[model samples]
Target: MTTSSLLSGADGAVELRGPLASRLLEKSPAMKRLLVYLWEHRAEELNEYAIATEALDRRSDFDPRTDAAVRVQVARLRQKLKEFYDDEGTLDPWRLSIPLGSYQLQAEPVTKDGAPPDLAIQDNPPAAAAIPTIAPQPVVAKPPASRYLWFSAAGLAILAMGWLLGSRWERQVQMSTASSSAVVVSPFWANLLKGGRPTQIVFPNPVFFTWVDKNGDTLLVRDPAVNSYHDLERSPSLSGLEAQRGKPILAQDYTVASDTRAVFRLAQYLQPLGTKISPSSSTELSPESADSANLILLGTVGTLAPYQAYLDKLHFRIPEHKQYIEDATPSLKAPVHFETVRESPTRIVAPGIVALLPGHSSDSFVLVLAGYHTNALISYLTSVNGLADLQKARTSHGNPEFFDAVVLSEVNGTTPLRSWVAAFKPLAKETR
Candidate 1:
């Protein structure tokens, strides 16, 4: 049969015959004809020109000038046939093939049992058989400027709300800090005065002190004139100590004089006790002397039998007291390269006395006696360095609730430690 006639017949019966003819036709009419030509003249050899001419039909309109386009069409159609058979006709009873330089078609039996050849043709019919259907979907378009405007408005609203909330929070925080500051009494001087002491004592704005007693007990001596002292015998004991009526002695009698010369002398005595001396001139401590001095100071502070018992109760060691100075020394001295080490050693000479006398809430004042050089001690006490270290320690030790507020003041450089008591004289007059 002519190639055209065989292709027409195959097209009509493609669904019943197999996927070969249907797939070839789906690609292009020229390719379908080429396939048919190959099938019909399978025993005949053919060249490219003959295949192209047959693909374009036997008409003058099928010019030699268009033979290249026709060949390309045929090649594309063959590829489509290959893809169809690979995807859906892999198990078909008939196999199709095309050899180069030849136009022919051949069918090979793919199934066993020697079934009738026509059975394959009857199995697939062209019409009335379902083919995969793909429905075209409509494309969607969006409005431009209005969408962006809505997004911008939402972003601005979020930013404005955040700014307002942040401002309000900041204001509230500032107010809270100011209020807490008024009531925040520092613990630096808590050990300097007795907790229950009723003495009329004055303290400077800033002070540091600790209790010398091992029990951490503060002595509360009553002022005979105050009504609170009248019931001292009936009142609760002072830090658990009995209250005895006696004239309060001046602080100078019990401690060193609070003057520069006194401080120098005290610092001198303390030199063997780890007290760092900043002399007017450059001087270096021998390594052995430095070690010996530090050892003595640490041993004396750590083993102060009275305070040791109390500190032990709190799990605090005297080494901890000097930790800040020791840790900060390297950083502090890095810039100055000061060979003569400047140090401030602080020790509490007395426990603070807090008296609940018959007066208003504001009538109370705390006594503090912090021992340090007028120069080095002032800088250490006023700076946030020590306070920050204490805060970090509290956190690391898992004692988040611990808070200490200290008032620190410098001793007069001109007077002795004894004469320095005048500076605190004014605190006794504070109204309740």
Candidate 2:
């Protein structure tokens, strides 16, 4: 609230200005957004999703299930912040740092009552607030006046995000909706939000497939949910099949009815919270979206196939076509993977993974729900009174902030006869 503080870089905390802002201007657009966002919204809870939705122009459609864009960019922003302070900001009196996985950028005065004696908050600013046209005067390293300019620079950084970040895509994206459901205030939910704030629910975008016939021959085709069958153009297997029997591939809109039902079921529990449970998928999941809010992700190995990178990050992972959970790192001799015998690989007891990890920011979280086949997830959520069961499952361990679960979905023709939590293991906080 201090205003009228004469800006300076040395002997105490100073208002941000010319030098600080100039240095930030040299960083990437994402970095600039991170810095400015922290400066303005420092007092509020922040995470990757908030940065993506609010800072990165990701709208309501944004998803974080399959995308790690927010994680990558935030890591880069941290590096740049270090570079700024180590170089141009070395002598600056204030120490500013955005804690890893958090949006709170804290500012501390080098001395007690470091703000200038003249500084005071007022409804109106004095003429000195707009000091302009001062000639660039040469100063040796660590000059006292340098503090003043640096404070000005910090102010400029805040101004830049408010004006510049918004102008870039103000028309393309809308602010987060206010109508989402009320936030759930529970020990389990609190672990996800870490601050009793809203969280996002992300679904998976499965890759679709089709079989097409041209003349007397049938051809296998891969569809990318697009208007064209462009991927089949380079298929060596298809080319070989064509040589034996003439045929062509066609495009079709892939639809899985059961998968749709699973999504609807997921929404039943999540959307009730309204805006607190913003819905998105890997296809549309922006890096920042998952960072900002606690996330609930749903899919199977087939549907979640696109998120292998994220799958690798999970402590309990069920790889596509693999019948076991890949957690050998903890104990190679231990048989962690459980499989059920069946006629078809697609129809066997599918493996579902439910995991919770530190979200993009330390204050947020990501919850992953998936199975081997798409139906495995659908059956579990729709049949076992999912909404209630999920809550029970989460609290079973006394509201753990991080855990990896191995889930089994026993199916009787797309209906989960019963579901079980085969194994549970606590995972270390995400260091990577």
Top candidate on lDDT is: 2
lDDT of 1 at 357: 14
lDDT (CA) per prediction: 0.29, 0.47
Candidate 1 structure quality by residue, lDDT tens digits, 151-255: 122222222222232223333333223222322223432321223323221111111011223443322122111122223343232212333323222111111
Compose the digit string of candidate 2's lDDT tens values, residues 162-182. Answer: 222222222112211121123
Stretches of candidate 2 off by over 4 Å are 1-200, 208-220, 223-255, 276-281, 286-293, 330-334, 343-348, 373-399
Top TM-score model:
2
- Candidate 1: misplaced stretches above 4 Å? 1-16, 20-24, 58-66, 111-432
lDDT of 2: 0.47
